[model samples]
Target chain A: MPRQIRRWGPPLLLISPSLIIIGVFVYGLIAININTSMTDIHTAAQATGRKPSEFVGLVNYTDLLASPAFQHSLRNLVLYTVVFLVGTMVMGFVWAWLLDRPARGEGIFRSVYLFPMAVSFIASGVVWRWLLNSNQGENASGLNRLFQILGVPFLQNNWWNNVNYGIAAIAIPAIWQLSGYVMALFLAGFRGIPEELREAGRIDGASEWKLYRYVLFPQLSPVALSAVVIIGHMSLKAFDLIMSISKPANYQTKVPAVDMYVFKSAFNYADAAAVGVILLVIVAILIVPYLVHTARAEKS
Target chain B: MRRMAAVAAVAAVTLGLAACSSGGDDEATSTSTGTEAGSGGDVEVFTWWAAGSEKLGLDALVGVFETQHPEYTFVNGAVAGGAGSAAKDLLQSRLQANDPPDTFQAHAGKELTDYIDAGQLEDVSALYDDYDLTDVFPPTLLDLLTVDGMIYSIPSNIHRSNMVWANPAVLTEAGLDPAATYDSIEAWFPALDAVQATGKTALSVATTWTQVNLLETILMSDLGPESYNGLWDGTTDWSSTEVTAALTDFEKLMSYTNTDRDGLDWPEATQLVIDGGAAFNVMGDWAVAAFEEQDKVAGTDYIYFPVPGSADLFGFLADSFTLPVGAPNPDGAKAWLDTVGSLEGQTAFNQAKGSIPARTDADPADFSEYQQSAIKAYAQDTIVPSLAHGAAASITVLTAISDATSKFTTGASDLATYQSELAAAAGS
Candidate 1:
């Protein structure tokens, strides 16, 4: 009994602080939010009182389902997540691939690409909004001006206003800001690939593409999965970019986070909590499967 | 590694300790007032007007308070955002923890109704009687501050949110007179289009709150002053031809606007007009302060106009000041409120802030020419309550309007859809 106690005591002691903090801040808030979602809290006034809010279980979820904006937000969110994932992954891989070759100033280019991550998300949103200003018309300054000079039709298209392109335009900043981190992950994964595997692939007359596909791609799944999870969560909570890119006049570009902001503005704390819960559910759905798969692979 | 874990643990411990220490300091600092009851004393006022000319207006009021009562220290706990929304949130949290500041900023009307309902506000009726603030402030403005005959908040500035500031240079450059009537402003729109032809911003209106501001002025201008109230508080149907016509006209007017208005703050939008980068700005009287900061005179460098047909215009009066409620120093908060509504406070505040004094009896000689016009209009009872975005209830309702209006401007929704959405939102 003494030996068993000794074995477990130090381990529990080491993790106790993290456990307490998470239990209070994370798990506690989650419980409160769940309670709020079950009741009718119209404003901050109604939210805190002795008269407990009537619990109409699942009614909030039903109301959310009935909301047009919520439906639109959900659809846009799916499109945003998928596109953001594919775009960041492809761009990060390509950039990483280019830098993987023995090249001059590789380190400088790598740092330059990653420098955006160093800036806060809000700052990135501001700078990009300035760059994308289309009010300058034909003499177009910044990105628009450069696009016009290069005879690129994308600038004249007003992609930010185009509903089909609005989400994509907002996603561009996220891609720029996050692709660097992805590239770093992929670079590490590439380095981790056993060199002898590539040599053996070549010995078997495998082309460079075959060598990457057979030798490197499988090995990079763990890194790629991590990148996807990180960027995926970031895109899900993407607020400042959507806010900066689209004004109140352009409500079709509204996302769940922006909608949540609106809810808070209206003092609909309960509904905001409901929306938050919905967002958490969606994120869990997206990530849990990947996490399970990763866990299984690790166990093997 | 164990070393990495140890380093992270140390960092976490340091952060937790720092946070705990700072929070303790904040609590201690807030409740340190030990003045005897009824004796004039120091009050730490928490507000969010710590920048630009706003700071100047605040300093003027503080200066007056110090002159009147030398015992008060006037702890300027001014935070960083305009309107103290950030500070208000912090104040609410502190109040919940039973450690509120002596005074804190609150909106004039139903915005503070929550605090009053919670039994967290003080009745300043006696102060109102003693200071004779009743004679100075209009009954309507007074009515908003009073709830069940109890005044909770004080008026700092009676800001008019429906003024259109135009650049005379840009107007002249476009072959349009700066003093063009709202009807003539339409004539200038094409001329303003010509200003954009010179590769400058024609109109500086942005897409968010500014769009809503422009929408309110346009609605009032098109529907007339009474119709503006009717659209929100009145029994009129928003689906009527008048509302549709206004929306269509506004969509057309938006074409003359800055392309990057979506991302611009109100000050930056005002800057477009100040720099002659834009022809006109449909903004508020607080914008007058921005122009003053730039050393631009009202009638010469820039122009102010009531959107045509909105002569008896609708103006949103959103003033801010701290209310005494479980306050650290109720006496100090009362002193602050008394000075806020005093004639001297009104004059200095109005001059520096570019807003009219809420007081009816305050001398208009202290006001700018534009404020004088607004004051005369108010005397005739021509001004109505502003029901644009902020003046209305519920952030939910406001956001719905913001979203609907955005859709209306972007051509994503027609007038019918917009009205239906607004009605649904309001009903909700």
Candidate 2:
């Protein structure tokens, strides 16, 4: 027992502080949130008082699933996730490819591309709101004005005001903000590949496109996957950007996160918690496989 | 020996973290308890008047508060957001945590019903008697303030929501009378058509809430004051033919508004009237300040009237303060409420806020030309709560109504669907 303690005690002691903090703040709060989601606590009055709320077990979930607004938000999430993931990865890869070889002013170009990532979504959202202002004709402004100046008035369509796919328009800003970070990831992935792999591809009489397709792109899948996961979860949890660009009541860009905020503001805590749990499950559905794959890779 | 030393080091670090966290807990507890023990300490008055003329009004009120209650320090806990949405969210969390401010801003009428039902506010009916407010404030105003014979808040200022602001230039360019008053919404449609004929937006509107604001006025105009009030108290049926007519009228009015109605805010829409891009805007009395900001003269540069068909009715929403149930300093809060209801405080606050004093007895000479008219109107007009500004319904119901209105205005839902959604919201 003494020998075992000597081997394990130091590491366990070292990790205990983080374990306790995470256990209480993270896992414990999630448990509380799940408990609250099952209860019929809708008002601040019910939430604060000594009397416990009645457990209505999954009623809140059933109600949320039935709600048109919640369903609309889910649809928005799927659309946003797809657009944001694809846009970011493609843009990131293009920039990474452009800078793969050493060139003059390459660092400057990279910094210019990456600088948007440093700005908070709220700050950038305010600017993008003006840039994407949907007013046309005499009231035209922002990018619409630019289109008019360029004599391409046809391009001055409502950006995020298109009812059917406005959430997809919102993904434009999300893509602009994160593609730079993805570019960095892809660049690092490129740097990590051995030079001999490219030489071997070239020696095999492969064209440039074939060399990239066979040798480079396959090796970069891990980086692309990482970018997708990161951007995927972000799109799932998007709030402030959408809020700053539009409003909570704005149906065109409303998401589940915004709905959660609205529900909480109305003191409908159970509904808010249900929305929160749904979002958590959605994110888990996305992340769990990646985590499992990483774990297995590490084990092998 | 070294391994044992490493284990002790790790244990010490873990103990330090635990100690740090516990220390934070102790500090938080001590501070909270200290605030709870407050007698004549800080009087934190929470509000959303963190910028613009609203902040100026708050400052003016704080000045009155300091003069009357020098024993207490006024803590400005104003959170900035358009329409107090952000502030209300923060206030809810604080209320849930049992850490309410000494006093907080709330709308008078049905908005207070939720807080009253939750037992989150204390009845300040005695304060009204002590201050002789019953004699000072109009009976109509007092009726709106009271719930089940108890008043929970003191009205600071009243904003008239059923006002139409028109640019004389735009009206003249459209060959319509700017100062002309329409007896009903039907009488007003031709004027909107005339402006539209001149290739201008007949009506300027902004966002979902503004549309809801317009809808409320139309409802008031069509149903009359009693039925309008009944809409909140469960007396009037939302599915009735009268309501359907009102919703139809609302849709007709929406057709005359700007194409980008959902993209702009109240100020921007009002600016359309100010700049003569649109002939008229239906906005609250706060637009008076917006016009004044642009150096526009009332009655010449701009013309004002009660919204068509809402002539004898005041579509009203008042900003009021409350004595929260677990307030740290109840006496201090009472002092604040006293000042809020006091003539000097109301005058100072209203003059700066571009709103009329809620009190009936305020001197007319102290106000502007438009406010003088509003003050007279308030005494004579039947005051009905403004739905868009949190006076007609609970927040949840109001949110539901707004959501339904948003869908209808966006063309996503039809009038029948809109009315049913509204009925469902009110029923819920």
Interface RMSD of 1: 6.2
Off by over 4 Å in 1: A1-3, A50-52, A244-252, B1-41, B82-85, B88-99, B114-120, B182-202, B231-234, B322-324, B392-396
Q: Give the TM-score of candidate 1.
A: 0.88
Lowest lDDT 10-residue stretch of candidate 2 chain B: B29-38
TM-score of chain B of each: 0.83, 0.92
Residue B103, candidate 1: Cα error in Å is 2.3
Query: Mind giving the per-residue lDDT tens digits that candidate 2 earns over A1-300?
Result: 999999998988888778667656676567778988999988656776534689999999998899887787888888988999999999998999989998799999899999999999999988988888887877788899899999999998888877768888888998998999999999999999999998998999999999988899899998888888888998899998998888888777778998998888887888888889999999999999999999999999
Model 2 TM-score relative to the real fold: 0.94
DockQ of candidate 1 is 0.30
Estimate, for each residue in B1-428, the C-alpha lDDT of model 1 and write its tens digit.
96686556655665575578669976764555443357666777777778877788788888888887777779988888524545655665676555677887665765665566556677777777888777877776775566687777777777776677888988887777766675633444566677877777777876567787787777777777566666655466677788778777678778878766665678888988898878878887778878877788878998887665566654756665655555767777778877887888878877876777777777887778878987777676455555443444434455567777777766677767877886666555
Q: Candidate 2 regions off by >4 Å?
A: A50-52, B1-39
Recovery fraction of native interface contacts for candidate 2: 0.29
Q: What do the candidate models score in CA lDDT, each in turn?
A: 0.73, 0.88
